[model samples]
Target: MAISFDRAADFYDQTRALPPEVADQVTECILRLSRATPETTFFEPGIGTGRIALPLVERGYAYTGVDISEQMMDKLRQKLVGKPHQLTLINADITTLPLESGVFDVAIAAHILHLVADWRSALAEIQRVLKPQGVLIYFHHPGSGATRNDPIDQQWRTILERYSYQADFVGAVTEDVLGYFQAQNLAIETVSVAELPRIRTAAEALQTYCDRIYSNLWQIPEPIFTPAIEDLKTWVQQTYPDLNERFESSYEVTVTAASRAR
Candidate 1:
């Protein structure tokens, strides 16, 4: 079973919400890449909190979102109140969709494939539900170029490994995902949607790790996580005497649009 975001529903938006301008740009990019119009139907598996679906829904597009977390879907429902949208939310697993075949014009997989234990099955289901030549838009944050060199993130990874914390991702990485598309003979196009500026203090970065905002951190056993976090904190203090000092970076959003050859 894939991990559910029920525990994070309340704070998910606060932590993961994109800036309004960036969100609009993402929606536009999806539209341009998929060549979708109001008549195109959209399907999103693991559409937790509607971060990617809401903008399209607001534009009068027909959309359906599926997820195992009712709490997360409820957050999306709350936002739909007093808003006109042709949207449907289903509580279900992505590996086996309830919808009929060849029904949707576009499908979205954003930061979600990594969570599914049987991601191949999920992708098969997505392909099954899409109309012939329908597009699949994959979205991910590759992090700014600086992320690889960021001492804070590097330390966090080191501490995590020292505690025997392993990532629980059962799906393919970016390269594997593209390989899957190639195996299926789907035409693929990649684009950089936007690069937004971000700034945060070292203390704030530490707090985010402590809060386990990232999904990969959710699986760490309490005992292991506690010690690992303490190690991270000590490293942060030793590396930077002033925890309040802020660092600037950028957040890059990339999209890979794959379509079955017509």
Candidate 2:
């Protein structure tokens, strides 16, 4: 079963919020690949907590967001309370949303496609709402493709190896996004695919996994996970004795752009 965003909304931003720099990159990449101008009206499906919306709206873009979780939307509302802009949020599912046809200048599905069981339906809806020549963008933090040799990530992998690992947005990735774009006859373009370096303490990253902040964490059985956690903790102490020591990591972000036929 998919994890509920309402339950996850409490500390969602705390655990998984996009850094300000990353948010800016998303906005800039979308605009650079498409014909959207500063005044273009943008829509995002599954715009949880407005993480990606922040950068664009700050630049004076008109934005509309749709999501099923009232709690998630509520959190976004809190963030926007004193902020000013033309922002509208619909508390609804994307597939059945009653939004008008061909009205939006751009539509973004950042990290959202893989979660929808009926992703094709969601694609159709995105197609419906975008005007001819309108752009559709998908943003994703792809699965760790390059391989992480870091002890901590390796430890997690060892534990995960014991069982079949599957999580939310499991089957969704960049290739799926491209396939959908092609099926809909939208011209596809790769906007960005670059590695960003990051640093974090072993303890910090380990705690995030243990808390299962991401919905995928719940997919692992407790019996298997408990042992893995213990093993990881022991290994971390043996390797990085100082909990404050930071280690390097490479995070990859991918953005895909497509246009509705004019």
User: Which numbered prediction scores highest in lDDT against the true structure?
Assistant: 1
TM-score to true structure, per model: 0.94, 0.86
How far in Å is the alpha carbon of 63 misplaced in model 1?
Answer: 0.3
Lowest summed lDDT across 10 adjacent residues in model 2 is found at: 141-150
The number of the candidate with the highest TM-score is: 1
lDDT of 2 by residue, 1-262 (tens): 2334887899888876667677667667877876767779899999889888877777788999999888998998887788887889998787776799999988988777666767777888987898777888887645532333456776677656655453325446666667777776777777555566667897887787778776656667888778877877887888888988998977667777788555
| Per-model C-alpha RMSD | 2.1, 2.7
CA lDDT of each prediction against the hidden true structure: 0.86, 0.75
lDDT of 2: 0.75
User: Residue 245 lDDT in model 1?
Assistant: 94
Give me the runs in candidate 1 sitting further than 4 Å from their true place.
Answer: 141-149
Q: Can you tell me which runs of candidate 2 are displaced by over 4 Å?
A: 144-151, 166-168
Clashes of each: 0, 0
